[model samples]
Target: MSRKDRDHFNLLCDIGELAALVTGSHNIETFMDSAVRLVSRHLKADVCSIYLYDESAEELILRATIGLNPKAVGRIRMKPGEGLVGATFENLHPIRESAAGGNPLFKYFEEADEERFESFLAVPIQRGVQRIGVLVVQHETADYFSERDVMALKASASQLAGAVENARLLMDLYEATGTHPEVQAPASLQFIRGQSASEGIAQGPITFFKKSHVAFLSGDAHRNENFTVEDFHEAVRQTSRQLADLQSRLAERLPESASLIFTAHFMILKDPKFIDRIVHQIAEGVSPPEAVKNVARHYINVFASSSHAYIREKVSDMEDLAGRILKNLFRRGAEKQENEKGKIVVAAELYPSEILKMASEEVQGVILVKGGITSHVSILARSLKIPLVIADHPHLMHLPEETPVLLDANVGNIYIRPDQEILLQFAGQEAAGKIAAASPSTVCRITQTGDGTRVRLLANINLLSELSTAKELNAEGIGLYRTEFPFIIRPTFPSEEEQYLVYKHLFDEMADREVTIRTLDIAGDKALVYANATSGKNPDLGLRSIRFSLRNRPLFEQQLRAILRAGAEARHLRIMFPMISSLDEFRDARSVVDACVRDLKREDLPHHPGPSIGMMVEVPSVVEIMPALAREADFFSIGTNDFIQYTLAVDRTNEKVADYYRAYHPAVLRGLARVVRAAKTAGREIAVCGEMGHETAYIPFLLGIGIRILSVGPQFLPALRERIAGLTLAEAERHARLLLAEDTLAGALKVLETPTSG
Candidate 1:
């Protein structure tokens, strides 16, 4: 590499570090200023400036600068194609111009003091085609800037775009909540930002729930006396007993999720990977306690750092299992002691049972210091009506005990030591929020729009116990029966008969109503131990869903045969394949089902020869070939979570780029429309069996776009049904039209937030 190239590279690295520093700090203005100053100084430029794109206003406003009139920084604004900076943004390419003022695209802004510079270079700062800003540098001499300079600025801008955009988003949210990311916080108030896992406001003293028992244990972990290998084995046995008891108790309370919630803990306890690793450490002369901690940390770090969100959810389980083992390591029959009643509990993460225990203890709310919202935990907290928030702030661990904490999970914000005014406002809002819960009894048997267009509201069954809730909520049928949950109930995959019993029960419970059972959609990265599954990098797009099924043909056929056997006497049954990306993949999966039928027939076993075969409309490739896919698929169900994730290239659970996971984006909306249109053209049925169906704002749009079926979490059915009751078909069409017309996320968000009316 040339000396100048190396220098430019080093400069980019320095700027990347600077961007990371600014992300944590409140002053984004300082980030912009420092960025411009560094670029100007590094490149020996006369001026450098940052122009942040204001999406709402459709203009790029100068936010920070070096060498220009400082007074004009916040005052100057230009629309796309209005000036050289605007032209950079419009063209979405680096602009390197000598005698820059001579270019017809360049418009002089009198307040900016740019006339002194004869050379200009500007790079459009963007995050995945979303315009963030423009970075500009000027030189005193004409044609002073070279390709190396342009390349360096481009690299810096690319690295800084995410930081700038995140900081910008933080500022906007803060502004909405009457706080400022750019301003210094008061001594009395500390705010922690996180995603709202559950809805509602909660205020109480912050109580840190310590699960790791290392603090209470006496002596060094690596050299503890009397705690030998036998003692560790005994603790493992005792931990198993404790888990069984906990599961039994949880069954009486939260039966729906209790069956397999503790299964993970046991799996970790007995697994050779966990147990043998710890034993190996002890054999290496480390004490049992230290060995356990070492092995647990190894697994926790592995799971937490996984690229896929599925594996990330296992971080909490590892912690929970470690805590259980540690608690039983020395203290036998340790009483469940918690002084967190009516107090806000702050934890790194909580498994489902921990959440339940907190709820039982009358805990006001929970603030998770780390970890993403696991499905089990989120569902349990929501079911228990406890406010939960996942705060990414590092300050959460150091919070003084018993300090007043206000958790506004409804808005996904936490305020530590909130003042009197904030407390009073929340108290008033909480009181106002007491208008009566949406009753399941109010949901119509046949849900319809105000104009009498029938809409089928199905339930997403994750467990057998959820059947009661689905029935009570008037769900028409099981739309997306996630078959993988049954797999997680045991260590290895369930045998054909075991799966049959589960499915048979489901069919019997739902009676004659159609049940769309998705085949095993397990990913390799999750905690569920499978002998056949192999971990890989980027498991989200790796052999998952249908790909995994096809790769393991025997297991795939086993599951299909089980579903078929169970649905032998059932009048209405559907088998759906997840993550179907292509026409050939769908045909391959369907052929397996056909083979399963032939095997069942040849064996003289009773089986459903023709269950409805369908595919989940999740992969982006499926959307393009929808018409052809619809012709082959007996029906189609859109898994909006993965669909939107795939469509936007955003990890739905990732909080860093959570803002980009937009369901209302024109591409996603159009994709859904095209699928629905294709299904109609082919005379095939399609249902949305994802979380989007749970959103009230999205329900109208779904209906507007001719989606007649919405399969949501059973708990959401009541509110969804109520929301649909107030909207006419015509109004929904209008809402859909507005959404389709929107080219920007901001415009789509505005349309979604607006109340529907003709």
Candidate 2:
């Protein structure tokens, strides 16, 4: 390697070593202090600082520092485009300035005492697409930082990203666990809201995630007789063989899981502190088992202490590796650990794969202290049928472990140490829930009100795993099949053939049932990592859903072709366009579907020729032109989720506006009534296909508006059927009339909250 390459390699190794030590600090305060000093010394810089991004405040707060005013650490904050450091974070790129104050964006923080430094360099610490923080280094001499310095620093920042994330997660956990002494638990019944990631109701004892690495505890490392270095090498080889076997086994079950997951474990084995340290100790007359245990325990502490819940999860990996080696030393089999199973898992945050592992272990539900609502983990939780909610209230962490908890993920309410009244209420509802869950095969698929009015019930499916549940619930058909999930979770846009295989499986499963395939609805909250170039300040109002499809016509055409070929022999197929704000957008989308059919015919491909093309009435503008749209569109589906958001001019996912994003808003109810009326007059079939369909509180209102069709998540189909069975069309109409008569939200809510006389 060249001298520069050699230097870069050495710097990265030093960073990894430093991070390992920082991980064992066990708290963010000590982790930060140790981290900045180590980084400054390793890079041979005058100053090293870390600025962690506070997402809620949208500012980068100086978390730790060396060679600057220490008091300014938490006080100095910068927005994404405010200063030099902010520019690097916003652009996800490196910024190096020879004269720091010369840059126009340079805003001096008097408390930081950075004016003395003429050489400044900064880089964004990013893991994949998520920006964790920014790393900055400065020197006292003009033009002191070389291009090599910039490259080396950037590489170091990238290497430290994982460690930084872990420390941050640990910090979040600590704050939640009552690190602040003054914050006390409420004496009375308390309730708080968070973003609901998955929809379900679960009541279980809360189990805080800890001690996952205790499976093979090394009780006080001690010496043994006749243990040598040769035995240690043999144990290493045996562990590799075991990992190989495990890789093969998992590849059969989940091919994607086979990718690079074991790379970290293998790296640990080759790490100098791992095999080398044990071998050195063994050579110094320590027993082979003793040396291995000591080394493994060290790493376990390093991983479990200050590590993020995601990284902390790997403490088990370290223990498992060491356990495999120790088992080889004693010739024993692996042990199983299911401590968190059958309980609600409480953690700061977890990776997507960890969520899968929890599901495999039969975890009843999951509560996150902090995480995004539309993240991959959230999406996976929904697919796996795990109830998930993210409650950011720190008081949650201090609650007594193993206390009976009631989790209502449908609305993001958590009751800790639930009392008698709450328990009784949950029990009555659970009894009804049990009836809905048991003997699904015997439950009739047809839904009818007390007045004998038929309301067609369909499933909204995303994952193939949901197909069986949909079938068991006896869904008449699929109302909205979100195709974006396959695209969002993947590395790139799936080709026509790849999409063909997926859609083909769905068609084969639901052969004779109606399947409405919605085209790629992405670029908003559900963004593709590969397409981060489309990131915007306001994602909801930006180019998303149908706009994204029309902009990328070739890709859209590719997806349409796949859907057509997949459903060639299907009895019923419908193509729906989402986020259709105007009539022109619908026409443009329908034309592409037509073109795909023409090309398939010309190429002699087996493709469905005439699937009903429909548009989602999600955008508020669609309501004003619903009459015009109804004349041309084959069917209409009122997506109440986005409809309420747009009608009230509120962001659906914004926690601050969550109260305003309500289904019972007076304007929202009137809009729904208008759309249903338009569809009825046009003689077009319409369905309430959003959460409103499954929400029993809003079901009567939806039915009252003359919606005879309802579709929701498959898991909800059974409960929804049970709810509709108790309501009559006449009662719903009366309820709707009473609700429409109210002008204010409070008045409308009162009318909707009135208990129905079954």
Candidate 3:
């Protein structure tokens, strides 16, 4: 063979060997060192270096060096368009300069190294459209690293992006599950049907933030117990600062509820106990990172292996807490890549802490890997009205990290490798959903159906912010203004004066219309600032709703006093209590209301007397004792949301059985019929303020059941009122009765959706 052919073959052999070694290397430092060495030897270059893209900083970080100044290996960063390497990254193409000093892109270089090198060749490493970094090979002869050499290096760069992606996934999984060697993506695709919560369509790029575990601890991480006490403290300090910073950033961006998760996580990181453990690791002579990693690992292991199921289950949370600390300590933003303008974020699961960490404006929607209809994340998503889907296929985590992805939350679908056609289709669908939502704002008006029964179209308002929206939707009044949210989020019992302020504001805002204020109906398990002060227990049957307030007479009286004061401020103010199981709970609550009115009169407190008071026909006992309870109460507002769960004996929080708690169930409908009949007999009004009211499909059935006030979400009012205006109450009643007698909810809904002869 000719010498040229032999040289080319040898270079090819060297490339293969280098590729194998670099791809197989577990240690990043060693991988770069060996890679640079191969480039220096094969290309006969005086200098070789690999510049990796530091995604968080948006700069090219020097990863390795050979035949160059040793200091440059650890201390070189090139901004985009700053140096020859930067120019290559900036242009997204390769560049070659025969004279190193003549290029304007050249920055400070080693004089001795420059003397020995005259030619330069830089190849931009790209994986798809993203440039991973740059590979520069320099030689003294001024003709080093030819076009073929650039092609070869560019090929090598492809493998590097794959390796980096693998390494990152491994790191993420290792931080989250503590299982080394991350689970690989499936060769074939699969899908999981997620529960639908919010109704909308959205398409955006995905941003994944899986909880990471703090890997630093004081142990023989590298088979050496060589950390000191000073090192441990330093490591603790570093990680603590990171955690604190993360908490600060999240607090600034997240809503009040979201801040709690980060707050709890921040506290865990600052715990002196963990800090001491970290110190112990340092005392053992481990490096700072090793010390932190070891201590964290040990804590994580103990928690994971704990016999207490709660403790063991909390390991994931603990890992997330630790990760927050590390994230804060590291405190680098997700580096922006080319074409990051509008990308949706998809994840296995999202917690408030992580979700809060992201920029809301940048996030179009989120697809979670693990969350449920009742998950806090879902609740927050609903509150924000953001499009989201929870518990998608696990394979979603394996998609290209930080790459553009499309999430279609409307149909509980996510499209991977979505080309322009698919994305355009999604955009069109999403726009249609939005247009449909906005188009119906002025659609509602007062009109009678063929049945000649007038149905009051009202809004089920929970937050004070919904008053304007309620008016905009042309709701006649507030059928149910859930007043329990404040109690749930408050740190202590809200004073009568504080309660009065809010109630008065709402009543005044809706002065021209009616407003039914449901008393504090806190369920157990949801964090309540005061009352019963228990750590953790089943709260469903615990002190909550009417039972909770009645037992605490003072609190109930205080709330009643506030309602009375607010009632005086408006012409139409209605008061209601939730979770009444029998006539006794109803009578007792009524007596309290009567007493509050009399006491207010005695105190010369100006208040409205004789405002309509009501009970929530939610519990089964209330349904059974409806007639007597209805006589004692002025009216009945059926809270079908909780009623459905209680009737089914289902914990809505339980992922395994929550789907069974359907509101349209025949059993629930029967209960609703009982309440409606009892209210009618008592010459009182009946309003439904639950998911049943919000759903358009269930409206006909509800009207047929003799419900006059249809209280629904503020957003649903315009559409619902429009539907109601076109309905005949008599036909609705007949349809509802026919539907209720049916054996299945689907059959009942089908009857409702069936065309009625106008």
Candidate 4:
């Protein structure tokens, strides 16, 4: 070979040697040192150092160095976008050139750290889209690193990432179990809240999460065994075989989505480039730990300092890979660990696959180390009503697996090492909550006040699937049936025939209960499938509900025809209009309803003899026109949630003002009182349907306001009914009057908590 080719050959040989050292050594620091030393020697650079990306800190941290001031070994760090390293990190690309020193992105510090490095190459180590770390190599001589060297280093860096990942995995395995004698039990428990989606009681031991438990364990000790060269070779062979076996098992179990991630892990464990580097370093008469640590440091540094965004993302995976490889090499006899279902999984955060691992019968509750109320996990938990907790105390990781833990999902509290008193008490409280939520709703007849005034308790229906919920809650009849859900999910407005089929089933299901069908009042933020109601920037204030129906008369007429035809077979059917802010909107809508009835008659369609027409009291303007609306309409359903938001000109979805979002605001109450009183005077039935109806705390207040019909989500009916069944009308009315008279809502709410017995 030519001299230059021979030198390149030697460089390749050196890299292989370093990889070998990595395979044999268990210590991360020693592996990195050996690798950096080789780079410095081969390049004849005054200072050759690798700066690794610290995933947790989101900064470049110096990992290993050669021919530099000893103080600079581990002290250097730079934020992304601050210097050459940062620029490389930010752009996820390599930066290396003779003129790189003069670039604005490169900031040179004039400290006495051995010698200044004018030549630098920073490449990002990545896995797929995620940036793991950056790899950096610097020299005192300008132009020392050419394009060819950069390419070679880039390739070398890829190999390095694999080594580092293996070492990290080994470290993780050691840290996970008591094999690392230094690790110990955590000091406390972490707790968080998740919606009680399913109503069931379960108690099981806490499984501590590694990320959550790390704070309790001191991870400074090396857990690798000391060994001779022959023993080390044998260990490497044994570990590689073991890794191959474990990988095969993992492949069989992982979902398709996670296959790529695991594949990367497998490749890292088997990468020849990584294996050779460590073995070479170990052959240089160095201790296995020292060799491993040195090579690991080098790989970690390069991985950390890498500028390629894709490559940078691979640093963690690389570290994990390297850790695993080391663990296999040194801890050959260590038992393989896997997530055991039928046991509580304590985790800082669970990926979707991890959640899927839970058999519905096995997992009772989920305790998260950190999550928010609006997080995806919590939202899913809400949809399922699974008890979950997030952001608890840090020591939750120390709890023993399969040990019974008292979990309070409401308050985000999990009692680890809970005393018998606390456990028994919490169990009793949980049981009561479940019992209260599941007890049968009684069928109560509407009674008059002391002076004999008739009260009507109607039902609110949103989802067609929840008709059964109304029956369980003992609703007198369907008072408010929203007809927008079908239009929202469908690609086009449901045809008249399609609409009829849906309405027909609902009418049939409520054969005994009176059914009130609202015409497509799909406006505001409510969208439709095939309608000209284009979305506005502000959907809440945009065209929807009654406005959309009125605008699209054809769609409205078709829907009306279907309702009339379906209503003909109903036990009791009524038509209601939503968002009738003024008498003009109400009268105009009523005229259309009249037109629909006239058309139905012309077509000889069967419909109720006289379906009562009603209007939804959701706007302040509606309250103003209540006297007129009450005179014309047969009944009124109070959409209190929207009424409060619109009256206050507040967007309930806006976080900044959401705290002020209250259903019981005096303005909302006043509007509701005005409409209900007007409807009462006209002898029209009024029902409260919205989020307010489902709140157990507001059941008494609603009853006090003479809102006999309560429309709520299916899941919330039990508690709401339980609250109502426990109260007398006289007591409810007295509390309602006091709540409305109060200046602040907080004081009014306190009135409801007076603890009246069932």
Candidate 5:
């Protein structure tokens, strides 16, 4: 073998041995010590150390080391972003220095006595986005570490990260249990990590949240086949009404986003395929509860196995729907128990309705065995300020009810049977109210650059309940009020009166400010089963947005009439059509609006003389013909989320290509620049209302590109305003010009990292 090939083979074998050592160990100290020894021996380094992130202290604590002061372990610490170690962790990337002592970021620890080391190499140990720790190796000789050495260390670090996290969690359990002599818990108190849906900390008794299981009736088919189709149909009707009631309650108690969950449940209950299968099962002489369970499991398995993450998440909604129906069919009721203040509710999965019903002053937090950050229940938890941790530990469901536990959703952790010190620490953290007060001040003020370039900051809202938050954050107006919400929440199409009520309410709330509402943008992927909308094979590229509305004229006219009537009730109303791929689509939608106005006039109804019309500039095709569409539309709203996705042909929801869906790609920046220039040439007002607008790093770029109106989620308004108020128009323009010259996303991102002023 060649020398280089032999070296590579030896490195792989060393990494394999290290991985085995780390994975087989359970003690934090022993695991960490072995890791450093393995790294030092394999790399032939003078010193090696591991630092675990202490979130509460906001510092990196040296956990274990070799070839340096052994006492430095558990004693040495560095604040995040303090030195080379901190910088490596903060950037989530590796850093190397041949002459470590010459670098300004290098810090000396007197006790460690490592000032003699002249070479440093460090890599972040991470599990997904969460930073577990940092791994470091150093040598007394300069230029001792090669690029290949860094690569080998990085590969070892990745394998060591999970083991490090598990060992730390095991240690925490031991300390909480007050077990001396370092005895590991029988089960190691597994901390099943998940995405943090809400941010808070709470400690209370864990109460398992479960629906009452239904007992299916059993008898000989020939002797007791007495239930009729009407009986099965009646059960369906009752379940529908119950779900509707829950929807109303959620809408009243939480945000419209939360209530949308029950809307999904309502759709599932009325799904033709699902209902037909259940009815068929009933006709085969199966009891109602048994049929519901069988059909639900079949759908759940099918959805759970789907390639799409969003589709797989729908399995939870299906399970919730089936359980609710079975309960209704069996006439089962929720368990009656005394309401205990500050209880931590645990469940296999929580539905939106269940979350809303559980919302009380007494309830402290929530723990779910299964849930996603995008789930409706998660949204409700955030809206209501409840701490929630979604963990899938096998023992979680089997835990005894009312068991004392600590739920730290801020870090996405749950501590079962926490000890006194841990409980006290959580109590102190809670008393500090740090997470609750994390949001900036609610003072209403106009945002402008240092040079006095006026910027209108608006809110993008999906529910009326969010308006109050927007108002508190001093949003200049409602820039993108998604109108598809009403359609998604109803079992059938919303009538003119029903749609009018919602629009009118929003108009009344934002009475003095401009409110731009985007029309229904639903497609096969987001279609309401009750709407009879076919699930096209390629939903994203198929019938959706303006195309769907154009084909369904009645649905289009009904919404337009309601919007116009609501505009009459409250001025400053604007209607925007989403996914306008062509000028013809915009013109067709405008004609429907014109017809609605004529009908309103013919009926002698009170209405505004005319409301401003706009089109969402999301598709690349629209950018190609923007000037032509600009002549007809009153204004333009750039939807960066979809624009980037379509421009790159990368599905943001597809994990395989999601990493390539870059919002700051050079192509996307050029597209935005072209749209802004087109709007300027046509003398049309333009605004941005997408996730990009909410990003602080993108703020300077957006402003630099001449986008004066920025719309974002209400929670982000404060931080965005602060960022905007710190920049000058000239600086932003200069930055924009520099960004336009970039040919890669990395180049564009690097421009953002530089100080905007300098």
Candidate 6:
């Protein structure tokens, strides 16, 4: 082979070796040390070192080194732009010098004894836009490093970056939670890391949380196949009853959102395909546990292999239900444990119903070996304000029950076998104080801009419980009442009476205030299994919202009838259709409402004469035809969430391109401006009922654009009210005009960032 070929071959080998070493290395120290040694040897350098960035301190601290004083490893630190290392990290580029010692930027540490090194190469270790640290190599001979060496080192540095980050995060958790390095198991076998589901810090003794444990039987223990089938059906019935009872208990103690968890569970138990699979297995003479395990494993594998995060989370739900059925088959009632206050529950996984059952004022937090943020359990945990971390650490399953541990969900970390100092530090960090203080009642008064621009602040509610919170927050009315909750929380379509009761209760609570009831917005990412809605390849652009409602007219009419019946008792009720891509869809939906009203009148049913009709302007197609839609529709709501997504053609949920889904994009701003202008020209009421409404930075821009109604989460009411009370109409209009003139997202953001005139 040629000399160049040989060098290239060696470089490839070195990269492979480095990857292996970094992957095999157990902890931060070992990983860093292995990296420096491997890089120095490959590049023929005398010294190699790594400096990790400390975000809180805004400094780079020396973590690992070769040919330097060992004592200086943790002692040396440099501020950004202070030395060669800092400059490389801050600039996010590589620095190479043949005469390193004489450079003014080179700061020599006396402890390192590195004055002899004349050539220096430093490169930043980065993960995307985030700069993690700097990697450096020095040679005793001047001009020793070459372009080939730089490329090789950069490749090696990239491999080490993620490992280094994981180590740093683990160390930070140890320090914060007081977990001693010595007590931790081998780095390769101990740490379980997962995404943060909820935010908060919690410390308490660990309790292995499980509803039941069953032993597997070989060949069904030779039990009769007919009996096994009967046993399976009986277990299914019992599991159904258990779920219903749990759902009732949860409904009494938690919000309807929490109780909805069992709804999914109930559906799984009644799923004919799932039950048939189990029955088929039982017919083959296997025990119920084996049948459940077999069927669950198949579904779990299918779901886990799905590319969508939402589908993958279903594995947890399926496994939870399978376990419930298995437990019932074993005739194992709910396992009871002694009352333990402030215990952190640890389990392989937790379902929403399980979380609700365990939720108590005394319960401290939760740790799961496997779960995703989209899981119903995670949603419940967030709603209940419980600290939860999902760590798939290998040691988790082996930890002794009741082992003292610290869980910090804020950063998705758990410290096993914590020390006294860690406990003391945790005690000093008051978790309760982190919660936002309730806005004072004085802020509950009517909100207007400084220049007397009356802006209606309303609440976007999905559950009846939120109505009370909305009232407490002094929301003027319900701007966006998502009506899909009742449908989503049932095994089958909710009856008109069931729907009527829910709507009646909401109307009774809001009393005279205007309540805008949005028809079922399902399909796409929010597909409901009970509704038999199957999400297509391009769900965002497929059957969703009004399209789904129109196709399933019976379901749609049922909801319309319930809404109309409830409107009879309501002083002011508005019915809105979601995802109206064109004028025809809106007119069609309005016609359905008209037909429902006529049907009610023919039956001598007392109903409201008529309700204001509106449609959500979310699709770009609708944006283009808003003038026509505004003329026909009674009002318009800008669903900014989907509007921006559809306009930009970006799926906000995909983390890969999430940064590109900018709400402040110039196109998005122009779109909003065009819609608002059209609504105003047509003399129609327009409101924004999306995440943008609650974002404080967007408030001034929104107000400036002539948007008079803003609907946000109930919790955001106080802060939004306070924000509106500080803005003036004139200044907002000026800011809006300035924002519209901008041609880029950055420029638009700058306009919003600037203080608006009060």
Clashes of each: 0, 1, 45, 115, 0, 4
Model 6 spans with C-alpha error above 4 angstroms? 1-245, 253-322, 325-441
C-alpha-based local distance difference test score of model 3: 0.63
Residue-level lDDT tens digits of model 5 in 288-366: 6667778877766766665434346556567656655655544433322233347888787754545655663247898
- Per-residue accuracy of model 4 over 584-616 as CA lDDT, tens digit each: 888888888788888767644466657778877
Residues 441-479 of candidate 3 have per-residue lDDT tens digits of 344456345455677778776556567777876788888
Worst 10 residues of 4 by lDDT: 254-263
* Cα-based TM-score, every candidate: 0.60, 0.59, 0.59, 0.47, 0.59, 0.60
Off by over 4 Å in 3: 1-181, 190-192, 204-325, 331-363, 368-380, 392-404, 431-452, 487-505, 524-544, 552-568, 593-611, 648-667, 740-753
- lDDT against the true structure, per candidate, is 0.74, 0.74, 0.63, 0.60, 0.72, 0.72
| Candidate 1 lDDT tens digits, 602-670 | 755678989989999998888779988987999999999889888999876667787788889999999
Question: What does candidate 3 score on TM?
Answer: 0.59
Q: For residues 1-758, what per-residue lDDT tens digits would candidate 2 score against the true structure?
A: 36565455336544225425442453456667777887788678899999988765788889899989999988999899889989999997788999999999998999998889999999888654457789999999888877667656765675566556655543333233312244445655357677688978888887765422332354432233465577678767666655544444433433222222344455465444456678888888777887887877776676677423444555766775676676566542223333456788887767565665465456889888876564557767898778999988777766666767788898898877778999899789879978965734567768899878999999888677788879877999889888876665333344454466568878998998999988887755576644444657887788788887788776688789989988988999999999899999899999999999998787555789899999888888887899999989999898887888788897765566666677888888998999999999999999988878888898888888899989888878877888888999989999999999999989998998899855
- At residue 71, give the lDDT of candidate 2: 97
**Stretches of model 2 off by over 4 angstroms after superposition:** 1-344, 349-354, 360-362, 370-380, 395-442, 523-525, 755-757
Q: Clash pairs of candidate 5?
A: none
Say which candidate scores most in TM-score: 1
Please write out the lDDT profile of model 6 over residues 1-758, one tens digit for every residue. Answer: 34573354235233235334533443346656877887777777899998888765788988899988889997899998989999999887789999987789989899888888899999887643346789899988999887667655665565455446544533432233222232434533423455677778877777666422222221243234334677778777776665555555556554332344443454455445667778888777776677787887776676676553444655656766776676566663443223234888877865444565576324788887765554546645665667888775646765666777788787887777777887788777764454434423365558887767788899888667668778877899999998876665543355454566678778889987999999988764356653445676887777788898889887687789878977786888899999888877888999999999998787555577789999888888877888888889999999998898889998765546767888899999999999999999999999999879988888888998889999877878877877888877877788889989999777887887898744
